[model samples]
Each structure stands twice: as C-alpha cells, then as structure tokens.
Target: MPAYSDAPLPVGLDALVGMGMNRVKLAIAVALAEHGGCLSTPELIAALGEGVAGTTIARNLNELEDHGYVTGDVPRDERRRRRTHWTLNHANLHADLRALIQATTPSGEPPTVTG
Candidate 1:
C-alpha cells in the first residue's frame, strides 16, 4: 500500500468490508483514526454515533485488537473498574486505508489517443 496524506479520506463500504474488516470494526477503525488514534471504549462508542450496544462495540474492539488494527487493555477506570482503552495502530491503518482507496478506484485500460 502507498503512503497517503495525514487526513482520513472517505472509504467505500464494499472496499472496507472486502478487506476482511467487518462493519463494526470498520466503523470503529475510522472513528479511532478520526479521534487522533486514541480513544477509550466509551469515547469510541460516542465517536461512532451509531447507537450500537456497548457489548457489540467491545466485541469489535477485541477483534480489531487481535488483528493488530488497534492496541490497548482493560485497565482500571476512574471508579476502579476495568475498561478498554483502544489506540489505532497507525502503520496498519495507513496500509489498510491505501488498499481501501485502491479498491474503490475504477480500473480499466488507458484511453487511446486518436489525434
């Protein structure tokens, strides 16, 4: 994958899901990236703004962490309860983003010059 600009660009649904990232994971990844690459579980949920259940978000976060797309742990929260803090793996994210952009591009033969 090629290097892209710092800003997070638009990613097509087909392209995103086609790269082995499920809907929830894709949404989470994008949200994390937009949030400067670090966000707690609750922050991530609010970032997504999809109204998905916390359990669902946790499940997707676990899967994303396992895939090296994100990294963090269930550390003690403000009240001393364990909570997940996820951070996007920028390297993997950039690579996946490049692939996603490539997937959305229309590929075909070059136009012929008749002039």
Candidate 2:
C-alpha cells in the first residue's frame, strides 16, 4: 500500500470535525479501509502522521474495536513483537461508513490503494 500522506483527509479534517464525527476514529477507519489488510498500531501512527499522539490513536483504536467498526489481533508467537494488528470490520456498517467517507472525498469513492 502507498504511504499515508500528510495531506488532510479528503474532506479536510476540520470539515469532519464540523460533521460531529470523531476525526481520529474516522481517520483510522479510512487508513484500515485503504490498507485492505491489518495495520499495527505503529504503522497506523506513522500513517496518521506525527501530529497525533500514539496514545490518542491507541485509545481511538480501542474505541473503534468496542464499537465493532474494527477488530484487533495480537500475534501468538513469542518471537514476534506483540503488536495489535487492526482491520476494518466488514461485518458491521461497512457500506454506510464507506459511503460516509466517499461522500467527503473529491473522487466520490472509498479510499483507493493508489492513493
């Protein structure tokens, strides 16, 4: 996947804030949706940029998980780093969420891999 850009989210973060949505959570969802696979906390932090504190992202990820918007897993092997890998939960309101994201984006499409 392409590196997450420092570019503001498609609708602009401020716009999302005005919409009364949790920006970090939505951003996390967007990142996971774009990745099309699991993303570790570190990867998410990097993707989201240095401006957002890791603690803040971690907290938001837990909230997203609790809300069933995302799921997280930890590697079982002792050799591997015990990082939680997160993925968007397609079983939930995925389409609606995607539509919400797409509506804010200029392309009117869910985030693409090429981005």
Candidate 3:
C-alpha cells in the first residue's frame, strides 16, 4: 500500500508536536480557541473531561503560560483559591494559531506540498 498522510496536519504542526508539544497542551489550546479564547481552570477541566487529572491540567497550564502561548488572568478581588482565567495569546499568533487549529481538526486536509 502507498504511504498516506494520517491526519493531514501542517508541517509546522507536525514539527511542533515533534518538538515536545504534548497532547494536553495542544488540547488546551484548541479548547481555548474553540471557546472564545478564554476559560477558567474548572471550565477547562470540564471541557477536557476526567481522563486527565486536575493537577496535570494546572501544571500544563502553567507551562503554557510560561511559554507565552497562554496567559492566566487573576482578578484583583478574587479569592486566593479562585480560578484564574486563561486566555490564548492572540496578539501575535491569532491567525497562525487559528490556521494550525483548523488544520489539525478531523476534517482538515493538508495542502499539496511542492518543491
């Protein structure tokens, strides 16, 4: 059988996944993008379901935040244990991110590559 593209993800995304962009991180970003680009930790946990632990999500969120891929917003009056809303960094990556997200979806097809 001829070799076929499995998911049709763009080259950049493939490279990103190869470069240690774990599934949870990608899922978080995709979830945020799909849901108005912002969500609290609890909302994310709910969206991601129970397979992933809450602590794991929190740690990955921090890692994403540290990498400038996402940001956590804490309200001034919020309590210590309250949730911090995470917002995907769109200032410099909105279009690129949307394109990547679209390309990685189930129905997304990769563009023909020519050299």
TM-scores, all models, native as reference = 0.58, 0.57, 0.60
Q: What 10-residue stretch in candidate 1 is worst by lDDT?
A: 11-20
Ranking by TM-score: 3, 1, 2
Q: For model 2, state the Cα shift of residue 51 in Å.
A: 1.1
Candidate 3 local lDDT, 3-114, one digit each (tens): 9656766654543432146888888888999999999999999999999998888888777765567778974346269878999885534444455666656665654422
TM-score of 1: 0.58
Q: What's the CA error at residue 40 for candidate 1, in Å?
A: 0.6
lDDT of 1 at 104: 61
Candidate 1's error at 104, in angstroms? 11
Q: Which ten residues in a row have the lowest lDDT in candidate 3?
A: 11-20
> Which model scores highest in lDDT?
3
RMSD of each: 11.5, 11.4, 9.5
- Provide the lDDT at 76 for model 3: 31
Candidate 3 all-Cα RMSD: 9.5
TM-score of the candidate numbered 2?
Answer: 0.57
Candidate 3, after superposition: displacement of residue 55 in Å? Answer: 0.4
Question: Residue by residue across 18-70, what tens digits does model 2's lDDT show?
Answer: 22357888788788878885688889898899889988987787666666667
